[model samples]
Target: MEVLSLKVNGDTRCLAAAPQATLLEVLREELGLTGCKQGCDKGDCGACTVLLDGQPVLACLTLAALVQGREITTIEGLAPAHRRRCAESPCASKQDKLHPVQDAFDEAGALQCGFCQSGMILSATALLQRDDDPKRETIREALSGNLCRCTGYTQIIEAVERASDEHAGREHRPRAWEQPATEPAGEGES
Candidate 1:
C-alpha cells in the first residue's frame, strides 16, 4: 500500500491505496466518489473520465500513485459553489443554478440513460474553461473520447455549443458571486 496525497475538488485528501490501483478504483472504492463509472476498463469507454491538472484523463487507466501531486476534478467537483454551500447547510437555499454545461445538457435533452453525462459534462467544461468560444469542430474533437450509447452525438454536441454560448455570455457580465453586495431593492435607489 502507498500513501497518496491528492487535491480533489479544491480539498486535500490523503489515503492509502494499493500500488496498482487505478484512479478510478481509488476514487470510487477508497474516496467514495462514484461519479466516475467503470465501463470497458481498458479506457476505450470514457465512462471513467476525470480532470487531472486541468487535462481530461481516463481514470480507469490512470495510476492512483502517479497522480498524487496533481489536482483531480471529478463530476461532483463540477457542481456550482452555491450547490456545495446548500449541501453543507440545511438553511441554505436549494435553488442554486446548475453549472453551465449541466444547464445546457438539461435544456438540450442531451442525456438519455445518463451513464455518459458526467464524463461529457466534465470534458465539455474542461474545453470551455480553456476556450470559452470553441467552434463546433473543436467541441467534437474535445468530446470525441466520450461515447454515449443512449443519445448518440447530436444533442450532445448541441449541448456543448449551448454551454459555450452561455459561458461566453457570462464572460461579459459579472456573476452574482463575483459582484459586490447590493442593498435591498426598496432602499438601493435612494
Candidate 2:
C-alpha cells in the first residue's frame, strides 16, 4: 500500500491506497467523495472529471500516488470553494452554498438521471473560471469532453450560459426548458 498525501478541497488528506489505484478510487472509495462518478472506467467518459490545480482532468485516468501535494477539487468541493471566496462579502451565507454553475444546472433543468452532472458541472466551473463570458459555441466546446446521456446538451449549454451571465452581472435569460411551451394555436383559432 502506498501512503499518499493529497491536498483536496482545501484540506490535506493522507490515505493509504494501492500503487495503481486511480484518483477516482481514492476520491470515491478512500475519501468518500462519491460526487466524481465512476463511469466507463476509461478516459472516454468524463464522469470522473475533477479539477487538478483548477484544470479539469479525468480522475479515473489519474494515478492517486502521482498527485501528491497537488490541489484536487472534486464536485463536493465546489460549493465550499465558492463559500470561501465569498466569505468577506455580505452575500456570503451561513448555509451551505451551491456553486453558480451548480445552481444554474439545477435551475435550468440540465440534469436528468444525474449520472453525468458532476463531471459536467466541474467542466463548466473550470470553463467559467477562465472565461466569465463564454459564447454558446465556446460553452459547447468546453463541455464537449463531458457527455450527458439525458439533457441532450441544450439544457446543459443554457445552464452554462446562465452561470456565465450571472458571473458577468447580466440578467439571466430563462432557459428554453424553463419557458412555458406555447399551445398550438387553438385548432379553430388560427
Candidate 3:
C-alpha cells in the first residue's frame, strides 16, 4: 500500500491506498466519503465529478496516487451544509461561504432526486468562473457534460439561470441554512 496525502474538503489527509487504485475506490471504500457516487465508472457519466485544484473533474478516471501534493474536492466538500457549517464557529474562515452556484441551484428549485446535483453544481461553478452571467444557451452549453437521469434537467437548467441572477445581486444563499437555524453555534460577524 502506498501512503498518499491529499487535501480533501479543505482538510489535509494521508491515506493508505493501492498504487493502482482509482480515485473513486479510494474515496468510497477507503476514506468513506460516499458522496461521490459510482454511476458509469467511466468518464462518460460525469456522475463522479469533483474538483481538482478548484476545477470539476471525473473521479473514476483519476488515479489515487497522482493527487498527492494537490487538492481533491468531492461531493461531500460541495454540500450547502458546509457553507454555513462553521459560519458561527469562532474559527470560521471567510471561505466557509458556499459558492454562488450552490445558492442559485437552491433558489431555482433545480434538483429532483438530487442524484446529479453535485456534478451539475460543480460544472456550473466552473462555467460561471469563466463568465459573469451566462445566457441560457451558454448555460446549456456548459452543462452539456453532466447527465440527469430523472429528466430533472429543466429545473436544473433553470437553477443555473437563477444562480447567475443571484450571483450578480450578491444575495445568494446556499439552500441549506438559508435562514440560519437560530444562528450558528459560535459565529460573530466580522
Candidate 4:
C-alpha cells in the first residue's frame, strides 16, 4: 500500500491505495467519495469526471499516485455552496439559493435519468467560468468529451445558455447554425 495525499471535498486526505488503483477507485473505495461514479471503467463515460487543479479531468484514467499533493474536487466538493448553509439547526433549507448552472438545469429540464448530471453540470460550469458568455459552438466544443445517453442535449444546451446568461448578466444566447434546435414535440417520432 502506497500513501497518496490528495485534497478532496475541501479537505486533505492521505490514503493508502494500491499501486494500480485509479483515482476514481481510490476516491470511491478509500475516501468514500462515491460521487465519482464507476461507469465504463475505461473512461468512455464522463461519470468519473473530477477537477484536477481546478480543471475537469477523467478520474477513471488518472493514477492515484499521480494525484499526490494535488487538489481534487468532486461533485460533492463543488455542490452548490448555499446548500450547506444551515440554520441554528442542521435540517434547515438553504436561503442563498442554488448556483445558476444548477438552477438552469432544473429550469431547462436537463437531467432525465440523473446519471450524467454531475459531469455535465460541472464541466459546463467550468466552461462558463472561463468564458462568462460562451457561444453555442463554444459550449458544444467544451462539452464534446461528455456523453449523455438519455439525449438531453437540447435542454442541456439551454441550461448552459441560461447559466451563461445569469453568471455573466449578458444576453448572449444566439441561434447559430452550429447550435442544435429543440425537436418539435412528437414530430421526431419515427
On lDDT, the candidate that comes out on top is 2
TM-score of 1: 0.82
Candidate 1 lDDT over residue span 17-102, tens digit each: 98999999999998999999888899898989999988899999999999877989998888855687776775654335467688
With a 3 Å backbone cut-off (N, CA, C), the pairs that clash in candidate 4 are: none
Q: How far is 146's C-alpha from truth in model 4 (Å)?
A: 0.7
With a 3 Å backbone cut-off (N, CA, C), the pairs that clash in candidate 3 are 88-186, 88-187, 104-163
Of models 2 and 3, which has the larger lDDT?
2
- Full-model lDDT, candidate 4: 0.80
Per-residue lDDT over 135-175 for candidate 3, one digit per residue giving the tens place of the 0 to 100 score: 66777778887888888877787787677667688553333
Q: lDDT of all predictions, in order shown?
A: 0.84, 0.88, 0.78, 0.80
lDDT of 2 by residue, 42-158 (tens): 888799999999999999999999999899999989887657667658776644467788889888999888999999999999999999988777787899989887746888898
Arranged by TM-score with the best first, the candidates are 2, 4, 1, 3
Clashing residue pairs found in predicted model 2: none
Candidate 2 has a TM-score of 0.83
User: Relative to the unseen true structure, what is the C-alpha lDDT of residue 117 in candidate 3, on a scale of 0 to 100?
Assistant: 85
